[model samples]
Target chain A: MSLSVKHLLGIKELNLQDIEQIFQTADNFKKVLQRPIKKVPTLRDTTVANIFFENSTRTRLSFELAEKRLGADVVNFAASNSSVSKGETLIDTVNNILAMKVDMVVMRHSASGAPWFLAQHIDASIINAGDGINEHPTQALLDAFSMRERIGELKGKRITIIGDIMHSRVALSNIYCLAKLGAEVTVSGPPTLIPKHIASLGVKVEYNVKKALEWCDVANVLRIQLERQHKPLFSTLREYALYYGVNKSMLDSIKKKIVIMHPGPINRGVEINSDVADSKQSIILDQVENGVAIRMAVIYLLSGKREME
Target chain B: MKTLLNSGQLNITLQRLSHQLVENHLTFNDTVIIGIQPRGILLSDRIVKMVKKISGNQQLEYGKLDITFYRDDVASRDIQVPNDTNIPFSIEGKNVVLIDDVLHTGRTIRAAMDALLDFGRPKKVELLVLVDRRFSRELPVQPDYSGHTVDTILTQKVVVFWNEKDGKDEVILIDKL
Candidate 1:
């Protein structure tokens, strides 16, 4: 069966089966990665354009690698290098690229709903890498994948998302994903960093970091988007670290060991201590590895939709 | 519909195929048996079990390979779900026997070969199948060890059912309605 929706705009748009299908497909892709020659010829006939309006290191490279591994021809368009700098509209730049016969578009933009906006104007399948603080679907998928790999099934599992919930696309996407998978979710951080309406999403909010850590099977720590913050939300980074930072001593205090996760560019010793980030319980690198597989699964499934004649 | 091979005949044919494999690759010293995923694994699993029972070599290297990622019609046709590909050991420089349930257009075999090569270069490669639709090959592929050969029209289909999976051991040919 195919995905009900052509574009993966957010986890909020995916049903449990869509998420499960992606995970199942990613399982095979993960196996493919373990082979001596990891590349496949599945998407040899397809061409994908990565159009990023925002800066990215891991996500962009992961998508490019996943596309290449599937044998898809990839063209990268960074806004800094492109005519998006010279007063070109997003539509104009994308339309010109679409004219070159791109079969799919994977994009990251600072503006929320940018990918959704592009999806309306283009026929090619659109995959949102990250659209502002709205969602980062692939990162969430990989995080869940990594979590499922470490722990068993996600259903009935307690997952606490710690750190900057208000400004994190990863946090928003993960909450939706985990909830759909029947996992109990909690968002924890300073009250200023956590969104006011977060509890409306059916997740518990914990101001005490240690209590959140004690209540969950997994702790997904999100980096504070310093650039996204317009004013001082917290008194100081040190105070935030002191109160909410996940450190070794805090983890040791928890009765049961909780799996630590971060959607990287980590503010080391801030949201998560380096000691904790490098700890054995952290499946950080596994998430990075699974990111390629998850992106491959997304692109492959999306590319399977027959091109319009 | 016509029965190609009944349960009794299917059983004997499998025994003969297993013995033939053992005769060619004695002791399986440097030879590996790989089953094409989904359907092929059923035949391969039985054959490997029988081969071990007869040769008394329990350590024979056998693997399951999925060729979904190597298909030529990936974008042009309906999407096929991928199965688990478990090749625990390397196939490099080994005499490889690729097993499948049916050899029809030979496209699956072609894709399997492409998938197989990605593991490493094999010393040699051979094809084995339970049923061979002799005249319908779209590519230049033939089975070295085939249980039964049948001639059929393009629209016809050959189906093999294993007792372990389908609750029966038989082969049937279905013509276009």
Candidate 2:
């Protein structure tokens, strides 16, 4: 199925069929990645802009690589280094960039709905790389792609996301993605970190990480948002580790080997143990690897034909 | 509207092509058969088996290539799912035989040529197509080995159905609806 939407604002805006089509296209692109010549000329004539309003390493690199591999001309704009630091409005900044014939914009901002707001004013397609605690659509797609690769169909699969659900864009996107794809999703962490009325999204709530791990096929753990939290000391790193940390011991307790996933910049012992993250059960790298292909699928679908330019 | 080759005729054409390949490169030493992916894969697989049988060469290297990304119309049409490119060994100095089911626009062949160049330079390259549609050329590409020549317009599509996977072997002209 062809993607009808011009901008991939968020997973909340997408249905199950749209996500599956992205996965289906991603499946083919993954094979292309395994070839001797990894690059494809599909997006040869298109151009992409990666506008990051926040600091990032994985998402930026993953998107840049995906765009480059698809043969699109890419330009990166960091808010910290760009005119956004000089008090330039996002509309003026993006419109100035689009004035130079930029075809698409993949932006990651600290403010919630930054991408949504940008999409309203831009003529070019806007892909929400990450927008505050709102959504990271590509991450959700890649996470679901990796899970679907390992465990056949995502329908009825048990997955529990552990860490700061309230602050994580990954958690919000994953919950919507997993739920829409027919997974039994559960959010587990300190009660304070869990989003309000999250249970209303139809996900089971679990406070204990051990209980969450015991009852799931995949543990999609997120890093604790320490830098974002300061005013209210909900839980210390030492205190969070005792309850939510996914270590080798906790993994051993579960008879069935569950897949471990973390959307990078891991807080190691705080969110999940290094051993568990590096273990055979860990598909963290696979998630990282799939990130590029998923991004390519998203970019290509959204960019449309080069002649349309 | 017209049938080019029936099941029996297709088998005969493939056997003849296999004989021609063996005659050119005896015993298949320093030769690799690479098929343009998605469709040409089956044709190459069939030809490789027949060539192995005819030449008594069991160690013939065969691979599949996808040229979706190398197309000229990438800017014109919606890019669909790409196929797998599997070439395990190096093609440094080997004589490569590029195989595909049909030669229509010749753009597929051109893209395949570009895709193949990413792999190490082959000593020589030969093109083989099952059905060569005459007079509708977008690129200046001609097949070195061809099964049958058919005249068609821009509106018609030449479809080659294999016996093993497609349940019956036949070539039919499908006009645009």
Candidate 3:
């Protein structure tokens, strides 16, 4: 018998088959989008609480949209506006929500592995939207789904993830997902941010952007280390852009079929050139659209309502 | 009713249905086939192999769907069993054929259709089933292709077993205890 995962706390909990299931469900869900009324009654009366400890617009909104589209009742819990500021612990807040009989919890916290911690304690199905720089499984799933849609297959494809590898959860999640889907993943950035031990996860590390670009089928340029700039991680943004930014010339040297991708709120002139961001090969928007479908698939599968259709 | 269509006869029907699926040209240009969970998924795999053999192409993608959440019976069932709905490939803009083992009251197909829409829009969707047990369907649903149609009493249970579930492929009609 195959093990069924109730909570999507981390990608580590999912094997190749589990990931494939979600992707397949997402494929079917995508068909509903073409209908006049896109909403489905699959999750009716199921209450989903979005507990975001960190401030976010895209991830939170996408989850909400997914929940709503699946006919679930959604309750948003913004940490800043909640009782957390009143000296309440994360566990206490979650326990209070659980007491209300919420069916599932989609949480985002600045603390790493917060979702995993909650999963150990809560009966409610847990979906980690983002937990610090630890992991973002859904983001990685959507990225993979988008890539599969565009590139046909992930097998033997070379994917170069450039930028702040150390702090970007997108990079971490993508590394796991890309490797699982049989893509040859490479991470490129300054030596400080690109850890040497990352290759343990079946990813090759490259410090030279040009070298990585030449060897890649897809270049996923990450945001510059602006949040960590004061730590003296890099000399300056200008130097980082010149050394690592996916500029027009850098794109020109690669295969014409090479597609560029980014997890949004892009620092246009920083990590990627403006012209390249707007280029034909860029699938940043496709990622956003795929995000909704992927999130919907996640919520539906985890709901655990198994009656014969 | 129990002896009318035995286990061995069911396997023969599925084998014949597999041939019909190939003959009907029921697949897509960029074919991505999915099976509704339990029996449907097993039948789908068998059909996938047969389809691949007929087309002489090994590139066809197959997936499984567990339409538990989408079922109309959710309100009535007190106990639920969660199964792995595994579809590893993307169905977007591809021709998707939803396969099932039996087509009964049409509720399962309705639920499966609802669940499929959540993934992504396919270019087209076609339904294929191993058995179309003629019963009063509550919904206006019909299979594009069927392997066998049996007229049976509503209380007669249709049980389909594949090599993955049981040791062999067969269909049995069980009288309710």
Best by TM-score: 1
| Poorest lDDT segment (10 consecutive residues) of candidate 3 chain A | A300-309
Winner on lDDT between 2 and 3 is 2
Candidates, DockQ = 0.65, 0.43, 0.11
Q: Please write out the lDDT profile of model 2 over residues A224-258, one tens digit for every residue.
A: 77667766746468888887788999899889999
- List the global CA lDDT of all models: 0.93, 0.88, 0.81
Clashing pairs in 1: none
Interface RMSD in Å per candidate, to 1 decimal? 1.5, 2.9, 7.4
lDDT of 3 by residue, A104-185 (tens): 8999998889988887887788999988888989999999999999988898999999999988888989988888889999
> Which of the predicted structures, 1 or 3, would earn the higher DockQ when compared with the native?
1
Task: Choose the strongest candidate by DockQ.
Answer: 1
Candidate 3 residue spans exceeding 4 A from truth: A1-3, A228-230, A305-309, B5-69, B73-156, B159-172, B175-177
Return the lDDT, model 1, position A139: 96
Better of 2 and 3 by DockQ: 2
- TM-score of model 3 vs. true structure: 0.73
The alpha-carbon RMSD values of the candidates against the true structure, listed in the order shown, are: 1.3, 2.4, 7.9
Best by lDDT: 1
Worst 10 residues of 2 chain B by lDDT: B74-83
RMSD, model 1, all Cα superposed?
A: 1.3
| TM-score of each candidate structure, all chains considered together | 0.97, 0.92, 0.73
